[model samples]
Target: MNGLEKKQDQRRRFLRTLYDATGGRRLTFILAPDIGTKLGLTQEEYTSTTDYLVGRGWMKWETLEGKASITPAGVDEAERLIAADAPQPERRNIPAPVIAEISRAFDATYTHAQIDNIFMEASAPGAPPEGSKLRKVAAWLHRINADSEVDALDIFGRLVREFLARPRWGTDLDPHAAEAYDEEDSRFLDALAAHGLSYHDGKIFGAGLLAPSKTLAELIRARDLTAIGKEFERAADKIASKSLGPLWKVVQRHLGIAPTPELDEDLKRVLGGLASIVAGVGAFRTHAGDAHGRGPGAPSIEPRHTRLAVHAAHTVVTFILETWKGSK
Candidate 1:
């Protein structure tokens, strides 16, 4: 083949590999070895191809430790290839029963709050729950007074398989499967496993046991602020033993807000106060008088201090979000 043909072939192969990577978690960091093994390329070939792509500014890489990640450009290229080569089938004509079954499965797996949130986002503006696609199927069953028929079951099964195979909505299955397994197949399996769903022979069977969708998972994950606060506190305590400056620097990084010299000094004072409060609390608790009203000094568990710390964290997050929005 000519040089042009060889480059085209390499691009096509890279695109195919990237499409496979999308099958679970839509956008994610993938290691070089995994990509190489998945694409049926030797380590050398994979490295060369990736390097060439990156050099051309079609892809980017980030290395932490020895692992490398494909940049956003790589993902977009892969998606574009899939769109060009394997367009998704139209689902508008799909039977109502199939939609109902899938919707029911989603309901069973997710909490009421989660379901409501998803429906709200997916539904058209001001539409009733029953007007939403998922809820529409559920409503159809109620109106017809019948369960999903065999044809509906088949359609649902096919749709499930297809859904599982797609990137941005599915999961990656066995990364160690055959050297040239279908990317879609791997993604479906990966998604099922990631969400704690059961799969057998490339079919989803127990979606009822899986956690909520990725969007819901993100919300739930972010809600664990108490644990996050404790972690910050621990880190702050460690840094306090050394110097408050380091901890203040970390806070700035986390909040994505640059600190002026004045801000830095103010942050140091806050950290010092926090450290003193923690120390004072420990000391008082350890050497308290017998009566509750006869403590050595004021109580260390000041609601105002806790509230301030929490407020600071919230303000930082808000400032970061505002900055991000403004830039966009």
Candidate 2:
């Protein structure tokens, strides 16, 4: 290049050497001919550049022996040049399946607005580029993991731990009760299957509660009280007629009650309560669950109400299954 451009380049190298050696905080020897040789500059060129920087207050010599340090302004200039020469971070493309899974987990737990806020925080001091909230958050997650900022599994694990810690049903119960209370639909259904009332191809016989229970779960997820209540009524009917009828035969033989259509008084009362529970769940759904249309003053249905219905269903189903198993 031209002489002037070449001189500017040499000055940059000198400042960079000083910045690297001491970050501009301590003096470095600048007089050695080998120093200029290492920088690909002749002694004359090095001396000329050093004098130019000193005159501009960009560097100062501490002694005649040439111990020198870069000035604050010189350090700033060096940093700017370094940044200008640095490569930009490469944009990474996240796969659709990975993004879909991430979005599903977060959507299940967070409100739309809350999720937006989370994405904003994760990419803070700068907002994510224009896209759907899911896409933006997914991209940020991918970028952070690629950069070694944090592992994606660690983030997911934290979310799971937080969800487990929170009282999803809004109750303050002991861990044992809560564990039984929060029986997932799949787990509860599996328990019923082992007791000879298995679900298959979306249909289940004997108990007949299986299909409706599955429907109830979906409705609950959607926060559909009216549909949930109607399904609960159907499930209760199945529990009373289909589920109990078969189980009662076994109970009669076990209790030494004669094989007859009529149940003895004591056993009748106990079994009747089971039917009553089913009826109660259905009734709760009818009145409070919004199964039927309401007046303007009708009470609002909350998540706790749905949770209560599900928990009651679990109790009935579990008791019946365990009873049947015990009798066998």
User: Judged by lDDT, which candidate is best?
Assistant: 2
For residue 17, model 1's alpha carbon misses the true position, in angstroms, by: 2.0
Q: lDDT for every model?
A: 0.50, 0.57
Which pairs clash in the backbone of model 1? 24-171, 171-187, 171-191, 172-190, 173-186, 173-190
RMSD of each candidate? Answer: 23.9, 22.8
For candidate 2, the per-residue lDDT at 147 reads 54
All candidates: TM-score? 0.23, 0.34
TM-score of 1: 0.23
lDDT of residue 306 for candidate 2 = 54
Give a tens-digit lDDT track for model 1, residues 68-161. 4455566677767777878654322233444454565554444555544543443212333455455654653343223323233223344454
Off by over 4 Å in 2: 1-9, 19-34, 61-69, 75-96, 117-328
Q: How does model 2 score by TM-score?
A: 0.34
